[model samples]
Target chain A: MATRVSPAAEDREQEGDIVERCRGFMCPPVTDINVLQGSKEEMRTRMEMLIMETQAEFCRALQEVDGGTFKVDRWDRKEGGGGISCVMQDGKVFEKAGVNVSVVFGHLTEEAAKQMRSRGKVLKGKDGKLPFCAMGVSSVIHPKNPHIPTVHFNYRYFEIEEEDGAKQWWFGGGTDLTPVYVNKEDAFQFHNTLKEACDKHHSQYYPDFKKWCDRYFYIRHRGETRGIGGIFFDDLDSPSQEEAFSFVKSCAGTVVPCYLPIVYKHLNDSFTDEEKDWQQVRRGRYVEFNLVYDRGVKFGLATPGSRIESILMSLPLTARWEYMHEPAKGSLEAEMLEVLRNPKEWV
Target chain B: MATRVSPAAEDREQEGDIVERCRGFMCPPVTDINVLQGSKEEMRTRMEMLIMETQAEFCRALQEVDGGTFKVDRWDRKEGGGGISCVMQDGKVFEKAGVNVSVVFGHLTEEAAKQMRSRGKVLKGKDGKLPFCAMGVSSVIHPKNPHIPTVHFNYRYFEIEEEDGAKQWWFGGGTDLTPVYVNKEDAFQFHNTLKEACDKHHSQYYPDFKKWCDRYFYIRHRGETRGIGGIFFDDLDSPSQEEAFSFVKSCAGTVVPCYLPIVYKHLNDSFTDEEKDWQQVRRGRYVEFNLVYDRGVKFGLATPGSRIESILMSLPLTARWEYMHEPAKGSLEAEMLEVLRNPKEWV
Candidate 1:
């Protein structure tokens, strides 16, 4: 019933390839494990730097593609941190897009620390201050083309101060694709790119985290995954701090390669009105998952000085929810739901 | 920006009023307190009859007004209950609307009983099966005309068995109005109609439950009430069951008088594309409150064998979310938000 489209329409596929914005800045070569040696604070600082660079580069590249203007809002948190949110709306290629980078440093309140312990993290400073710093790059893109899947990427580094001056640190995040229609080659490309990034860090990266993503993004009520599974790792303090930081660096660095190709693939493809309506419906599911079930979003909403706009910028510009809607049994839409109900091993 | 709308739309103002569907049934007159006598099962059966009648009459009248055919789906729950769902979509006046009646009776597990106790219910069954039965009629109307406010009504009866085989009985429900564009005449009519119903039962009914509705429907994160509240009461097992049942019946019976005149006033009123867009945006807030904050929605989702479609029929067919969306200064949209942030005393 809400199958209404507005005028002022533009398609990314109708547009040509984006002009590269990276003129002279060379890529930071992967730091060797020995060279990456650092204390928790040092690692946090490095992660913060990398995340900011990623946000700038990604937004610039996106701005080139959609020819959309990005509004950059930088604000400080009273609780000892700040963030920069770059958002684009009504772009030629993208409908709504956000790339946010935040680095927060603060001690957890007693109740919060206790909740964290209940969630299974061993805190070294039980009575003392549970000093923590979290840094991350998070992005969500809702493309103009329903055929072009909505994609999300987040990679973060976390440090918890321990008793006796020791510290606990780890990295977490993943990238997932939510398509209005399941395009096989696009899905494969998405997973393969992320798989390559993961394999560069560890052999177990793709398989373990891929399964974790399947579990992590599951929409229990709907009995389906949010999208095709991607790598998701949390509390990943392994081999050494250097190795972990390097791995997160690799994951963070590979975001564009992992997502852009698929964007290009469907950029110009024409879609029927039905497909667009279906896309809106799928987006309704996305909103449901983020608001009702996503822990990261829950934490953000609960955290003091939380930026509501950046937190909810993940929602699509428009969505629909029909009562008890179901696609005809053998339709392409039905096929898409089938795949989502049971995610595929794309790589 | 989602501030866009399509051209192919009609308004309800152009249509004539619905032929009254109350012709076939006679209202049950209130019983005097001294003469009232009924067992728990007898009272529950009477409530069920009244709710079922309400659902049928409401849907029949709506069908005449909207010129939209209703699809009736009746199904039974695995948990010793069943429901009837009447849905109309893409109507002449309503984009989507639903009227549903459910009668459910089942035994609560120990954990569920504990949760009830935590909510301030003094359940007698500490280690035994808690017997419970609930009957209710709930309806949500999402009109096509942006000027026509969305309305929701619910009245329910609950009966719980104590360890000593004694029954605890009560009635709870209210009707609320959510307008995309606030109209003073409409707000006055809505409150006055509901006030008349409340005053028939008790002098204090309007004030106490109006404040409660204001508190209950608040969207905390957005700092706004969900709508201009009507009335809401729970666990009202006092002043005799006869008075309570008669009060809820009076409330339910007055739904048409409360909403029909407003719908008629705005039905054919022309609106700009911007107004329709704002309506969609406000509906997004409605969706947020129901999904994130409504305890009834949470209960519906958590309860075993809950009819998902009926539970979610309250959602609008379409919604839009724009990042950091603020209405233009001194605009009608802005004024609506101002009132929502500080709910008014409308009479």
Candidate 2:
């Protein structure tokens, strides 16, 4: 059972915790754990650690709230490959959910490898297929509370063998929030935290790329924005290894501090049963958009080594179907429509 | 009340009719309705005559098919502008049907005019918003026969005010087919007819743009082609009015010959009641794809100048939903799935 607290109370506690954590944590901390800089084994080991830490932190945060505690149901390790499937069900915060985190290292098929090469990149393998390895940490958090956003984050590193057998690695990751309700302040705080982290890298990075994220998540058919917005960056690689390393580290470190407070504040708020029902209805659209239109979902589903449960983790606990129901005039639902019609810069 | 004939019987009669029609029509005729394009008043009068002819032809086709004539529900003129909305419903070949063909010429909103201006080439619109005009024939034919494909065809001429106060005119249209069943031979016949028409214009045209039509009609989420495919081209405007006029005329003229044979062939075939039911279920996916992802549907729904029935006319008569039911192994459904999984050139 979760200890109940008001939204304001949660906010105060979260703010203090975030501020304290920010002060104590310095960038580029020393790590004694060996992560091989040049080998696929090193990448795989590092990815495994990353997955454990990310999932543990997610569970710890969820347990603090009134929603259910999710236990990892299964973890299947791949033999000829590498992927871990973790599923959870009937939890206070989640219902029938799976959080899959996997790191795979393998060669692409001939056709697939050719397409990659045409994109001005080469892979390692005979028959023109490159020997490439990837470490991806991905999660779908479908919280029990409709007010609590169903969030998604994916961070991955890719490396390929060169002609001389040298490995070249690149980093990419982004965290995005998908909320049922529109709390402008929560959205602001979410983007603000991300912007601050991004500023440490480059000033132009936050605003330019944040707008890109907004455009990216938009469901053009529904004419609505997906969740408010957050930080998203991809292909963060450079000739300089140090620069790429710093970028990935900064993004990964910002995830917990940036999102947890917003989730914490919203989870405890007083919401009517009616609002919860509306939330579920809205979630149905999210599912349709993701399953039907999302490029990431399509790509992952089409991929050979895809873990289906983890890929579909962002689906809601419940959804609805009406003959056709446009939101009532001047309601919160209508307000959401107005916001959607005109894109806003929350940060 | 509808006429029924064997395929072999019709094939012989159809050939005879074609021979008689082509005997004297083979002599190339040169003519121009150029005077009709002199002014808006002249164009309007010419369009009215064309509309009357089009309506008469449609009425004749229906009367001959059913022996009992289908009644036109009514034709409504625009309250604030000049346009006709011809509608009909609950006919022998159609249920909940609407055939709306309109020719309206008027001014556009400043925003709408501005968007047009961004296309780089200025039309005959004023520097700001000027008197904009359009004349077009658009129709959606939804046959009650699940065996017969639901078809859509549109031929439009758009004129906009240029920055210099001249009129910029262009023509655009094409016909497409959506079939419930996978009949490769029928699909081939349909495309072959259209390709022959297009080939008469430019040798390179059919192959290059036929692929475009196939790619455009795809519902990416379902990974299914909209129907067996047909021809589609938009904005066939060029600098020289003479060249543009000839191309546009060719595009619009191809509709009849390309479609008539395919329609006769499909409609004459008998279908079982169960097949009809299955058609409806497939239509459900069509509805989901359109309402959920189609841009044209979204734009029509959002725009003030939209007609609901016309926009939704692309929907099939029936649809089905089951909780995650994959088709039986080695069935026709699986055959369709095979095609959907990997598209190929049928022609």
Candidate 3:
């Protein structure tokens, strides 16, 4: 340039524009501002920006309902990249709500690769390590009211560069509902909203992904599903990247409509101490499923420089484990247990 | 006039004597009374009797301290043997206490054999299956008082028969403590009790097994040991089977002495709500360790026909998880966290 401007100076000048555009985000993008601005067309940048937007929107929606602001922690990994974790604890409605978005870059580990293989991903890495980038938004909202079912969702994008400089990418995620007490109307509304989102992309997505969700969230030792199914899919390298991204966008965008109406309906409903106890006990099963069998949790725990606080933010604020706890016959709790034992099609 | 007693009648005659001898047990042994009477000399029978006795004694000690009696469930496994689960929940002093004894006989799955091999056991099976017999006494006591700490212990013996008609066997177990508040005296007392028991068998037993315990109970993601170190050993087929049994007995016998005094000392200590919250948070860590890293728990969950309630009875009655819950600088909780992060020699 005639003025001889340094690249660093140029980056600094653009950072202000980046920050302004990212104002609604829970925090700044995990990637460097200059990198984000320069690589706006890249999928990694697009995914990062998407997750940041999703996290902010989700947090704002929760705040409006709970009258509690999220306490945000912007954390960096020693290896590479970082994340923003926003938690609303002990709110008027929500007991513990966490929304997290992370953009991570590192060498893919053998363990992580093996896990991906089990999920049917194919990759050829040099010396069992591949340069990779992962970005995702994950959330779990545990409400104080027993009648308001717990909801969980995660959407992620992954890319790996092989020794030959070949880029391989995929997308994965799901949305599910867990209720302390079974409500037909709530289940219908939740599943119907998810089904509608899926139908926008493909007719088969709802049925196929709902079945996948049931199988994925099973508590095998207890012979029960984690909750009534919604939709789950992984390794979505479909007809086109744009189409898959559009599908995921539709699913993520429906979170508020899918969950908030159930919350609004049950927010004022009265519940007994026994119902609360049942919720705690159900939370115990949640802990068991996540810790014992969840692939994402195992991968996070195994990964070097992974943020555990964000990974384990999926757990409920409080849980209970009682020896041989069982619901009495013909009780509402028992009815819910029956549905958990046998998942039903909602839509 | 010899009465020409049939085998069934003879078993009934011996069952009377068996019931009389088992009067003090929480429940009758898992093995059939007749099989037990006939195979009194067999290692499987002896181990079953030993664990039943240990379970009964441990339950009684806990009851004496908490003024709560255990509710016992004697259950049978359709495939092979059965178990006795004794739980004292919502006690005055103890929040939850469980003592379980099981004598299981089955064709060991490849998974179980793989776990055993990881523990350095040399196992040769036919078609990845071996007929195995296992009997164990396991207990976890969560005291209500934050200062009292939680204690867990298990003692077990395993015997496997190879396809070549050769028998292989070993003994494994440990005792450990987790405290919400750090007390040097309590740690010292607990470790010294275990060290004394270990020294009775071998001079190096305490140091070696204590290190093993620290390694075994580690919560890797948190970079902390589950508790202060104690004696932990597996595959203890030492100079002789009798010697190993004696060593295991000594370690198991010290449980009451090692933990009860700590309970009594802190039983009356007044704790604020914050302290109670801290205890709940620590229990969350305990849950993390048990669910994520405990080999026994993994084996139990993976094994078919395993009793889920009995296996998970090691969990606390109530536990709490909070996002980024860090103890204040130089606080008591921080002090405990430091020791957990860097395990200290107490004996």
Candidate 4:
């Protein structure tokens, strides 16, 4: 894994206008060449290379806006795997940004394997080990500017391999937005960008998956949605494996288009101290949702001997929990709450 | 319950010495007294009064130190019982102080009832309704001064009735401290007070309960203890119900001795902005433990029609999470973390 980043990256980023700066980016670097070797382990390595490359590109794109670079930490799990966690703090654009890529393959614990039974077949190793491989890239960005909305995206693949060389696999992940102040046009642009990606694969994909995103990202205890929803789908072995992989890749492609424009639009916009305080307050709900309810986070934490930092990279840099906080009735803050209480068809 | 509080309460709090101001506290006014009727329902009310009185005295002591009176909020659950929540904010001493007493009795959903079977037998109402009653006072105090430690204490009593007029009951509770910067003498003082209280009732009580507290309050993901341990016990239905209640009350009585002197010791002690930042960072750990791993919080949140505010009073007014933060070696902050990593026999 490469760790060095050029210090002048942001200065170069400022030379071009928004669209010119963002366009014509190449596909993420792919280095794994053993895909045709016909081995499950090689395939797992191929997927790992994809997510690792994706992590590199995503962090590079964010570096352009922030003027701060990532410090990479490479760690290993004694049980079987390791991960690379790239983190940035106190950047010009982002208050905190963490993009983690983990490629872990090992014998699943009994509890984790049993939980997996609901989704697909659990293929054990020749020695009766519950052999499993998982690779994913999950990123959460909390920006310094309140106008620049915080965003999160994660795409993961999992596979179970059996003694007879049979395999059962599935794919999961999504991207969502959390804005301190809701901009109707921003919300529409976000959803529309993702809808286009989904439409290319299947007409029904956009609507069904959009609804899934709404339900999945909800903060139940607060009785509010985490943000204006994007698209989410999981356990996608349904239509066909090749088709599923293509759809996941397409969704991954949309993440930059889906979120960066809003960042570009509001990156230079200014506000008051009160507005910043309001952003910190709303970030508290994001903390509650992840630590208290997100199934992936909980599942990751519960997995025995998993690396803690990589799993918790989703938390914001700072949050506030005011007692019985009630937004002033009919204010912009109140308007945001009203929308959060009821989900809408963003398209 | 009486809702009116004297606005002059805060002015009066500043007149006396620390111990003098804390003593001669008035019990909360009791509005339920059907205990002598020899019904399970009446017994639950009696236990409710005990916790309510405890809550009132606890708040009164905090007010003296804070020079700020609490605002009371009374609410009811549609299922059965209600609660009184006393909260203090923007005080001279405390940033946020919440003391809540709830007496809830009603049917338990099947999943909840099934989980409770480990404690005792569950008896349902005539229509197959699983009857349960819970009464408790849970409090969290967040201090304004960084040197003064944050504290939490909770005491609860529960009972389940049988069809044949037989009763099954138990008691559970604890008090613990979370110091931003640990003072060794202070740690010894806090634990010694609780140990003396425990020894008065039983010789084995302090050691056993202290160990339990250590294990229970641990933040496993961080590979660190939440704070220096105090005392915790649950499912204490052994020997006799009256004995268990006395043991729990004894631990509850130790709450003030365990924490107040440290407040008195550090209340006016000057601290740096960096120290305050460190305190907020530690508070972030407190938030992580409660929302992610605390069993009571999870159970309470999952209970349908539960009062949301009272259940969430443990959160601090503010917290911060910097990525992969490391305290400088030989620094006071690093010293506090050392003690947290390896607990001691503070006596």
DockQ per candidate, 2 decimals: 0.57, 0.04, 0.77, 0.63
Clashing pairs in 4: none
Candidate 4, residues A207-256, lDDT tens digits: the string is 88888998998988778999888888888885776667667777777777
The predictions' CA RMSDs to the true structure, in order, are 10.6, 12.7, 8.5, 8.6
Share of reference contacts found in each model: 0.71, 0.00, 0.96, 0.75
Backbone clash numbers for all candidates listed? 4, 24, 0, 0
Tens digits of per-residue lDDT for model 1, A1-347: 21212211221111211112212112221222233334324776567656766777788778877888888787678887777788899899999999888877789777777877897988878577889888788999999889888889898988888877788888899888888887889888888988877776666788889999999988777888888877888988877877777777777777888787777777789989898889888988888888878888877777767888888889888888888889999999999999989778886
**Which prediction has more favorable lDDT, 2 or 3?**
3
DockQ class, candidate 4:
medium
lDDT of 3 by residue, B1-347 (tens): 11211122111112245556677787767777787888776777767766877787788888898888899999898878888989999999989999888888888877777877887878788887899988889999898989898999999998999879799999999999988888999999999988877766677788888999999899999999887767788888876876677677777778888998988888899999999999999999999999999988998898888899999999999999998999999999899899999998997
Q: iRMS of every model, one decimal?
A: 1.1, 7.7, 0.5, 1.1
Error of 2 at A268 (Å): 4.0
Q: What is the C-alpha interface RMSD of model 2?
A: 7.7
Give the candidate number with the greatest lDDT: 3
Top DockQ model: 3
lDDT of 3 at B212: 96
DockQ for model 4?
0.63
Off by over 4 Å in 1: A1-41, A124-128, B1-41
The true-versus-predicted C-alpha distance at residue B49 of model 2, in Å, is 19
